[model samples]
Target: MNNYNTIVIGGGPAGLACAVKLHKNNVSCLIIEREQYLGGILKQCIHDGFGLQRFKEKLSGPEYAERFVNEVFELNIPFIVNAFVVSIEKKDGYTINVSTVEGIKTYTCENLVLATGCRERTSKQVEIHGSRPKGVYTAGAVQHLVNVDGVIPCKKCVILGSGDIGLIMARRLTLEGVKVEAVYEIMPNPSGLKRNIYQCLVDYDIPLYLSHTVKRTIGYPNLEAVEVMEVDEKLKPIEGTEKIIECDCLIVSVGLIPENELAGRIGVLSDARAKGARCDLDFETNVEHVYTCGNATHVNDLVDYVSESGEVVADAIRDRNDSERKLIDIEVKGRCAYLVPEMIDVNKKNNKRVMYFRSNKILKNATVTMKVDDKEILRRVYANLRPPEMERIVVDYPELSENSKVVFEIEEAK
Candidate 1:
């Protein structure tokens, strides 16, 4: 049995950040990573844009990982590489049974941080009817091939899904001398960051077909062409709008789903909307002492946010001595998709609290009003807000009375 003060079940930015923060406070932790090396998906992402908020400088994915890896190494934090945690069971008094190499390993710890991250939704998940061709690959898979394995999947590519990965891949393939025919998005607006759309697609002269989708892929051994079509507001295909684009490869970047198998195995409560474990303000799950962060909690587009979440978990673990932690549930109704840390406990030591949430619809020049039992407590106006971009709001802790229910609502600003 491998015993530690805490166990972090991932080696990505979130996991590493949590380990580093815990280690700084003299808390011993073991980070178990399934990959041969640390960094997780960040290792395969070679493009820059990460670390802008975290480090105040733009860095490539690997570079960002290296910074955290070096920090962990400096702290002498031990990690198990190539060890997949199949299941986790809370034993007597918080010991975790982490199934890994050398059989079922048990770690006695006061806390467990889950940073398992997320997985890209594949073509199979979307059930896109098409020829099973060799040239079709997920944008992340192709990214791994080109950036990690140093192999380009194809010369001519038609990318489906204008999400961040697809947009970035479009630019990446173009830089590799590959002909990127076009990028198709089912939504009217590109599902990626506005900056990415401008820099990766528009600047690269790649055509972005919004409200469009790939109807069918045509090819045998490799991709040859894709039948693209426009869609109505309801996303139903519009007749007579089918157009074929000849390409040697098709890369799908549909979306990402939080990897929550381990979370489910432990019987942790999860929100179907977030598709991740439901966490409290301390990042703790329904199961006491088990905390979740990063993409494992929700798909965060920026690494900075992941690190921020790590810090939250670390703070909670460090401040567990506080017995006055009071549970406060945050309800998102009316135009809100969901909120992170579905619940929170106000720390009596501090009267300020931060909350993160995303809306179900895009709002331009709108105000977000937060209330407790129908009484307006806080309100903030923003120039623009989208569901894809997570937003943070702060509330006065003193305003939260005992048994008070808080609700968040979005309204157009005058």
Candidate 2:
């Protein structure tokens, strides 16, 4: 049996960030990773684009992860690789039963952080009617094979979603001399960032078929073709709009769902909209001393945002005993899909609070208005808004009164 002040699950960017912050605060912690390596999904993301905001320099995914890994090493944070946490149960007031390889280990900690990250929504989840054939893969799996394992999955491919991973894969495969037949997106607008659309698809001349879907897949023992169809506004297949594209591989990047089985096992309250834990402003879950961040809380597109989430969780844990905490509810409405840190408890002494959220639909030239008890507090406009891309807003404690209800909405500017 091992014990620690804090236990962080998964060695991804979020977990590493949480562990690093705890270490800096002179707190002892342990990180448990299922894989032998600590980098997580970032290891397979070899393309440069990460670290623009966090490091102020563009770096490959591996490079960004290496920077953090170095910090973990320098701090001498203890981590167990290839150790999967099968279950977590709150034992007493401060001890948790963490089932792992060496055996069922009881970890007594002041805080617990869940950074298990997210998993790709697979073709099975989408229920695509087709013969199960070779060469079909999730975008992340293909990324690992190509970028980490250094092997191409196929020569010709068609991506089934316009999410960031699928769009990036289209460009990646194209760069590797593979033919990307097309990227089919059922939504009217691309699910990924506008910048990815311009850089990865438009620049590479890869066609993006919007309001379209794969009606059926055709292949023998191996994937040979796909039947794509244009859809009406209702998303029903239009007659006579079927087109066949020959491809040996099909990559699906439909969406991501938070990996929260462990959190759920311990009966943590979760948000219906975000499919993650319902957290207070301090990133603490309904269970005291247990915190969650990164994709496990909500799917964030940028690694920097994940790191920021980690810092928030750490700060909350560090200040858990503060007596001036007041719980406040943040209501997200009007075209917004979901918001993170679903509830906020203003620490009057701390002076500042941050909120993260995303819109449900695409908006152009719009201003996001936030109000506390019918008084406008903050507003910001963006050239565009999409659900997959997260938007962060910061608010000061003084701007909101104790026990105040904060409301956030988005509207287009004339």
Candidate 3:
């Protein structure tokens, strides 16, 4: 059996960042990754637009991941690659069962950080009626084939969903001399960032059809074409709007869900709306001595935020001690989709706590208000709020007395 101060599951950008911070602080940490290499999903994300916020320069996914990987090496943080953590349960601290080639091994840690990241939603999840075809692939799979494996999966393709991955893949296919027929999005607003919409679709002159969706894919052994349909405000397909677009490949990039299998095994309560573990201000889950960060906490729009979250968790882990938390549940109003760190540890000494959230519907000139026990504490005005773009806000808990309650509401600017 091996032991450490903290054992981080999954060696992606988040896990690596956490380990690096802990190592710098002279904390013993181990990172367990199932993949053969570090970097996680960034390995296949060959397109640029990353590291703009973190590095203040445009970098591809691999480049940005390399920065963290290099730091991990410099710090001499130990990591086990190609080792999958199969089970985890409480044992004094926590016992992690890892499945390795040599054999299953056991490791114990005082605290655990889950940075399992996220997984792409497949065609089945989106409920596209079609037979299994060879040409159908997720945006990530296509990206790996094209960038990592050096093989273009398609010469002509129809992309479903306007998320960043799908949009980037559209541009990538276009640059590879492949004909990108169009990108279909069921929602009225594009799911990707505004800049991505412009640079990837509009800048490249690739057609993007809003309020549209893929009805079905027709093919025997491979994809021959995709039937497109317009969706109503409810996102239900409208009859008589079916348009068959002939394409060899159909890449689906609907959405990403936080991978919380490990958390679930340890009885960590997950927030259905956020699709992640319910965490406090310190990013610790309801489960004792267990914490979650990065995409496992929530699906972040930027990978840099993922790294930042890792550092936050690592710092929190450094000061962790068994103590009763003064927890306060956060409530939302006025089209608020969801909020990360669903609760605040009022007992925590940290005055300023970073919180992230999104609005359910498009809001223009809105004001976000935070009230403690029915009294206004924090209020910020925004020009606009969209579900696709997440907003990070800091709330100060300076004047909290006994029986304090925190609630958030978004009101359109008058």
Candidate 4:
């Protein structure tokens, strides 16, 4: 059994960033990746606009990932690709069982970092009733087919959701000479980034129908058409609003689910709202020494933020000690969708805390307030807030005790 100081799983942007930082700090760490390549989803993301936050330049997905991949290689950081983690055991520290082309191998580490990214929501997950067809695909599947394999899988397509990936594919398919019939979103507003709505859909002259959903897919062996219907505010389809549109493909880009099966297996406490692990200011889960970052923590809007979380994990582990953590709950209320680092570790040396949050619904002139007991600690106002865009903030850790009351609220301004 090979042992190390820390073991970071998933070679995506998060894991790559964590490993690079660990190596720079002279910490022994190893990266285990399931894919043959190390870039994760970025491998097929040929579109530009990534790395603007980290590199201060517009770069393609592969280009941004390549910078970190090159750094990991140049640093000689140990890593194994095409390696899948089968099981994990936590006794004193942690034991990981990985299955690779060679064979099953065991490794041990004092600290574990999960940067497993996320899984795309498929048509089945969204309950789109229809016959099982060949042309129905997730936005990611179509992306890989076109960008990675150079195969145009469809001539005409009806996208079921206005997610970022779906919006991007509308443009991607159009560039490939495939006709994108329209993008149907169940929500009243687009679920993707504002820029994507303009660049991917508006720029391509693609039609976007809000408050609409694909009620059913009509096709034989391959997708031939779909039944789209208007939905009420509650997202229930209207009876007589169904309309048929002929197409060869139905792409679903509803949303992404955090890949947290491993974390669940180990009995880590999860945040229902975040749909991920419940962590503190250090990104350390309820289970001591076990940490999570990136999309594994929550689906992030930007790849740069994912990498930023990896850096947080590295710093957390580097500064970690045997001192007991004083974890206090951060109660979230009001119009916010969710917040990460749900707890505060007042005992940790690092005082600067990074937090991420999203609005539950669209709001203009909204105010966010953070209060400790009856006294307000932080307050910020936003001109506009949308569920599709996540907000990040950095604030100093406030004085906290075991009984200290911490509350975060989002209120819309009149």
Best by TM-score: 4
What would the per-residue lDDT of candidate 3 be over residues 1-414, giving only the tens digit for each residue? Answer: 399989999988889888999898778999999999999888888888888888999998899999989998887888999999999989879999999998998999999999999999999899798888889999989988889889998889999999989999899889999999999999998998888899899999999999999999999799999999999999999999999999999999999999998899889989977999999888989886788999998999888888988888988988876677776688878778898889777667757888899988788989899888888889888888988898998878665543777788988766
**1 or 4: which has the higher TM-score?**
4
Structural similarity to truth (TM-score) of each candidate = 0.94, 0.94, 0.97, 0.98
Stretches off by above 4 angstroms in model 4 are none
Clashing pairs in 4: none
Q: List the residue pairs that clash in candidate 3.
A: none
Candidate 1 error regions (>4 Å) = 94-104, 322-328, 346-350, 399-402
Q: What local lDDT score does residue 224 receive in model 3, on the 0 to 100 scale?
A: 97
Where in model 2 is the C-alpha error above 4 Å?
Answer: 94-104, 322-328, 346-350, 399-403
lDDT of 4 by residue, 234-348 (tens): 9999999989999999999999989999999998887999898889988999888999999999999899999999999998888888988888889999999999889887677
lDDT accuracy of residue 282 in candidate 4:
85
Q: Give per-residue CA lDDT, model 1, range 1-414, as digits (tens).
A: 367778999999999999999988777788989899999889988889899987999999999999999998898899988688876767854555545567776666778899999999888876466878778899999999999999998989999998899888999999999999999999988788889899999999999989998888898877889889999999988999999899988899999988888878878888877888898767888777889999999888889889888877887788777365576778777677778768766543434555678877788887788777788888888888887788877666444555878787777555
Q: In candidate 3, residue 108 scores what lDDT?
A: 95
Model 2 vs. true fold: TM: 0.94
Candidate lDDT (C-alpha), each: 0.84, 0.84, 0.89, 0.91
Q: How large is the C-alpha RMSD of every model relative to the true structure?
A: 2.1, 2.2, 1.4, 1.1
Best by lDDT: 4
- TM value for model 4: 0.98
On the 0 to 100 scale, the lDDT of residue 289 in model 4 is 90
